[model samples]
Target: MDQISGVQQYHQLFGTKVYDADTAFEFLTIAVFQAGMSWKVAASKIPVFKQVFANFDYHKIAMFDEPDLEAIESNSNMIQNGRKIRSVLQNAKAAVQLEPEFNNLADYFWSFKPDKSEEGDRDTIGAVVAKDMKKRGFEFVGPTTMGLLLVGMGIIERRPNA
Candidate 1:
């Protein structure tokens, strides 16, 4: 599929949904894996990720021990990046911690949504969220990744470059 259609499909699949913490963590994981790769390539690996990562269940993922990490590392179907793989585990733990502060991961993420009149580019907005997430111990969440996440979540629209 072309980029536009691929993005449209992604938005249809992810953007329009109401996220609970599990779903929110799932999409955040997607954004992490999508970094430095095309959406098509990243999207293709999602099914396997879901299977290996216990359907993006943060609580389950938080419990993933070294054996689980080894299984994921040994899985030929996975992305195979050690750091990114570890980050998923780390982020899961971080997401679990968010429950007490914000009620849920979804609420914490959604609280960053900017108003329509906000005057900043996607990177600018994403940086704000990224900074906060880093403070809370989330990994693999740089500005660009978070920008894509925001767009994917439909918290912010993807705008054409000026």
Candidate 2:
């Protein structure tokens, strides 16, 4: 599939739904894993990821210790990237920290949604958000990852032909 359809399919499958902070974190985690791999490959691991990550509950994940990381890193069903696993833990901790300033991670992320008329470059907005997220202690959240995250969350519309 082309990029447009790929994004559309992803949005249709995962984004067209009401999402809480946990769900938002799930999508962000998917984006993290999507780096250096196809979305299909990354998506195929969602079930195992959900099972291992405590249903993407950032609170639970934030509390994960070394044993938890070791277990995940050793799991054959997971992507087996130690850095990505560690980043997930870091991102979870960052998400938990957002609870004080925002209602939840979802609230903090949705705050970046562009107005309908202001749907300019997705990469530009993604970069801005990525910068803020890095400052807030999230890991593995660069511009490209943030762009995919926004697309997966339906925070930004996908171009029909790009």
Candidate 3:
């Protein structure tokens, strides 16, 4: 396929190994961290994030001690914003807390969606941004960003087979 988009090209080139939710969750953490920054910058430093954050393990992040937080703050490859670093840790904690309440982090997250019926439609990708977001307590999760997140993390398959 002559890919029309960068992400599409990434999928075509990288294949489906990137489509797991755990990977998505980890990458989503990177995206959440990059909420206001450039994706190129975020993508460039993902290795640092992986090493410093213990591969985005919610169990570990939930148990992160002060030393871990300090280490994350001192890491040169990550965003040094103490607050953003803390947010990822906090979100990890939240993910852990959420796990017991559902099948998995992906289920808990997708449950926030009104329905999962149309998930296969790439053209409806923007529908992820529904009006119920604020009421659902999702802070930075908007439709477009969340959609990109689903793609990056492999939660949602890209076009053709999506």
Candidate 4:
């Protein structure tokens, strides 16, 4: 298996090479899925999510049917909780509403920039921005999860030059 840094791995997996709006949108949706679970588990199952949810295309997910829900529920590769599975579809639909006015998910999401003047004091990148996500009105975006997404997607540069 090919090995890369965590940021590289997330880029390989979700195309969030930088802190762009699209990447933030995907990370936000993924964070909702990540509630009460480990990102490693979520990361491993992302491909299944992509296949089931039409590559995380908001328009496509908004139109999912019962068959899609059923397939996701039965998939061993996913979290399989009915609520989390359903959230994916619902979040996608929500994305539709947000997209027309906002440039991308990141644009809306990052509108809430935290007080980062003291960012240099933060030992880790994750520590820097999860606080901002909450202040920004993002629900379910805990520091750790936000940190993971930020670090993984290069939204926040990784510590120690990873």
Candidate 5:
């Protein structure tokens, strides 16, 4: 109602708000869900995900047992694909491992921002980052997905003032 696209609506909520690690996790969770689907579907499910995943705190989600994931699996409000739901925990766990290396999960994710020159070829940057994420034990982080995530984060955006 307020914007042209679901993604634009998403940006209206978050574009100017710089998030900490917890919120970054939430965004990434939705980003993963957005893969192979419309932004509308993924955006609609965010509130549900925030409630289910303890506001995307890596400390909490990383500790999620089978029962927790199962609960999400059974939640009718969610997109409910078992793999994506399960990956929330897996990805949280991976993010936890990166916290010590960087200041937090957000810093680690932000560190992969493609250089301005490299922005024109996001697929290449995404491939590189995706490989590293896979090496770090994250799931559902394919190159195309990573590229889209960068776009969502505004890290790969075209310069506005230019």
Candidate 6:
């Protein structure tokens, strides 16, 4: 896909304006998969992921067992990292678990939105969120990951001109 369409596809897929479950799962799964890969490569695989992973439905993904994980791990079309795949599964569980604490992932994520719109924050909130996430049994999440998630969640906007 071209750059424009890629951005559009990603925005539509991950809910650029909406903070619903579909968007949340897409953000987490895509972010985790993009850990060490180029965004181009990861973005290109979005279709395959959607088809194979049941459109990133966290509730369904949370129910995936070891066999399901192994099958996905061996699939050449996917990122093929056992750890990341497991994070996908575990994070789904975390998503399910977080439903009660917050209305939804959007509510939880937006709670960390910076006070100043023009100014961006990462260090403090990222660290706190990452620490809490780890404590909640979420894996593959670090300060860096949390920072990126915040950006994806539109909690913090990246200044392209900066």
Candidate number achieving the greatest TM-score relative to the actual structure: 2
Residue 113: error of model 5 in Å?
Answer: 2.4
Tens-digit per-residue lDDT, 1-162, candidate 5: 432554555666554333478767767887789888986788877667778989778889999998888888999888869988888889999999996789887787678776667767777877888899999999988898777666656666633442
Model 6: per-residue lDDT, tens digit, 27-69? 7777778788775566667776776677888888889998988
RMSD of each: 3.6, 4.5, 6.2, 4.9, 3.6, 3.0
**RMSD in Å for model 6:** 3.0
Per-residue error at 88 for model 1, in Å?
Answer: 0.4
Model 5: runs farther than 4 Å from truth?
A: 1-9, 13-19, 159-162
- In model 3, which residue pairs have backbone atoms overlapping below 3 Å? 24-153
Clashing residue pairs for model 4: none
How do the residues 1-162 of candidate 4 rate in per-residue lDDT, one tens digit apiece? 235443345547552455464445567666777788765656655556666777667677779889988988998877768877876676666656666677666665444333566333333445545555444344565667666665555444445644
Off by over 4 Å in 1: 1-11, 160-162
Model 6's alpha-carbon lDDT is 0.74
Off by over 4 Å in 3: 1-21, 110-139, 154-162
Full ranking by lDDT = 2, 1, 5, 6, 4, 3
Backbone clashes, each candidate: 0, 0, 1, 0, 0, 0
Order the candidate numbers by TM-score, best to worst.
2, 1, 5, 6, 3, 4
Query: What's the CA error at residue 147 for candidate 4, in Å?
Result: 4.3
Better of 2 and 4 by lDDT: 2
TM-score for candidate 2: 0.89
Mind sharing the TM-score for model 6? 0.84
Kindly report which residue stretches of model 6 are placed more than 4 angstroms away from their true locations once superposed: 1-8, 11-15
